[model samples]
Each structure stands twice: as structure tokens, then as C-alpha cells.
Target: MKNDFEDKMADIMLGEAVTALLDEDVAISWAALTDRLRSAIEIETDEDRIRAGLRAIEEVRREMHVRNGEKTEGKRVAALTEQKLH
Candidate 1:
């Protein structure tokens, strides 16, 4: 028997996972945007600005990868569910 806090945490985790999975297109767009940002960053003359942009791009890439993983997991889950239902 799960406690209320545990149940709430599980729900929150599940919601986050599902939301991440649903934003597959957004993740792909972010990847493209990061690529563009990298190109812009390359031509930047200001060292500080270049470093900041790189940091931001890395953060966004990390998130995009996470979303991509979630999307893959969601697809696998869907496939398994479909197989079970048939």
C-alpha cells in the first residue's frame, strides 16, 4: 500500500514522462534550433557571449535528448500494449 506522498510522487513522475514523450516534435525542433545557435555561436567574437551560448545550447541539448528517450520509451510501451491487446 503506497502512502499519499508516494502516490503523488509517482503521479508526478508519470505526468512528466508522458509530457516529455508527447513533445517529440518540440524536441526535434530544439535540436535544430541548437544547431543554428551553434553556427551563430561559432561566428561570435565576444568570448563571454560565446561561452554563455554554448552553455545554453548544451542545456537545451540535454533536455532534447531526454525527451527523445521518453518518446522512444512511450512508443515501445504502446507497441507492447497493442500486442497484449491483440
Candidate 2:
């Protein structure tokens, strides 16, 4: 069905967006990231598909935040260990 195809396209778009986000060598702000997603999704005329893409992007953002927090925590722990050893 057409609806199913649209859903699949949205999923593929979301995957591409997440892959670009993760593959970045330099860090980018959340606002910038969302702005980029919004721009990318602007080409979609279907309201339902747009909303679904946004929801998926939000989930990806949350997961990215969690991963970033974990990385920061690991660095902090390493710093503390080094300080204690000195």
C-alpha cells in the first residue's frame, strides 16, 4: 500500500539521519541537529509521515544523549582515577 511505502521511506530517512549524526567527527548541538532534520523532512508532503519522522528523530536524540552521557561519565571516571594515582 502507499501508506506502507511512506512509512518505510520515513524509516530509511531516519536511519540516514542517525547515521550522519553518529558519523560526525566534530560535535554538533542538539538544536542544530534538529534543525537539520526539520530541513530534511521539509520535502515530505504527508502530515502523518512528517509527524512519524519527527517522533523517530526525537527517540534518536534521546538515545544519543544517553550515549554521550555515558562517554562523559567514563572520561570523568578516568580523570578521577588518574588524579588518585598521582
Candidate 3:
């Protein structure tokens, strides 16, 4: 009974959580995360809901980090810049 927007939002939120838990590169796939979120929402248990809510919070934090451009790598910077920092 969820609308398209709600479903999409849930998937996005779930993706963020998995990304945070597994690290940005190793997180669960979007398809898998979405399925997991949907399953969590469908469950009647309070514990499961709480767990899923925690995951959702982690995901939001990760997304915020990316949005703020905090993540960086020396690998992408030129050798000269890297050397300057060292």
C-alpha cells in the first residue's frame, strides 16, 4: 500500500544505512537494501523496527557526509600536492 514516493524514500534511506555499516564502497547493493528495508517495515516486532530505525539513522549520517564533501583521498590529488602535505 506504500506509494511510489514512500517506497523510493525507504529504499534511499536503507541504502544510506547499509553504506554506513559496510563502508561506502562495501555496502549492500541498492536492490538488496531496498528489499531489506521493505521487509523491516512489514514486520510487527518492536525490536526489528528499532534496529531498522538505527540503520536508517546511520545511512542519513553517511549521506550527509557525502553531501558535505568531507570524504577525500590523497590518491586523486596530484603528487606535488600530496608531497606538500607530507
Clashing pairs in 1: none
Rank candidates, lDDT, best first: 2, 1, 3
Cα TM-score per model: 0.59, 0.58, 0.32
* lDDT tens readout by residue for model 1, 1-86: 43454445434433443455456544535755566557656887876556555666666668888999999999999999999999
Candidate with the larger lDDT of 2 and 3 = 2
Clashing pairs in model 2, backbone N/Cα/C closer than 3 A: none
- Model 3 alpha-carbon drift over 4 Å, by segment: 1-45, 70-86
Model 3 vs truth, CA RMSD: 10.2
Tens digits of per-residue lDDT for model 2 on 1-86? 97677667667767666677778753566665676578777997877768767876776688789999999999999999999999
Q: State the lDDT of candidate 3 residue by residue for 1-86, as single tens digits.
A: 44454445555557555766576455565445555555555663665454555456556557766755643544446666878999
Model 2 ranges with Cα > 4 A deviation: 1-10, 16-36
lDDT of each: 0.62, 0.74, 0.56
The TM-score between candidate 1 and the true structure equals 0.59
Q: What's the distance in Å from true for residue 52, model 2? A: 1.4
Candidate 1: where is the Cα deviation over 4 Å?
Answer: 1-28
Per-prediction CA RMSD (Å): 12.9, 5.5, 10.2
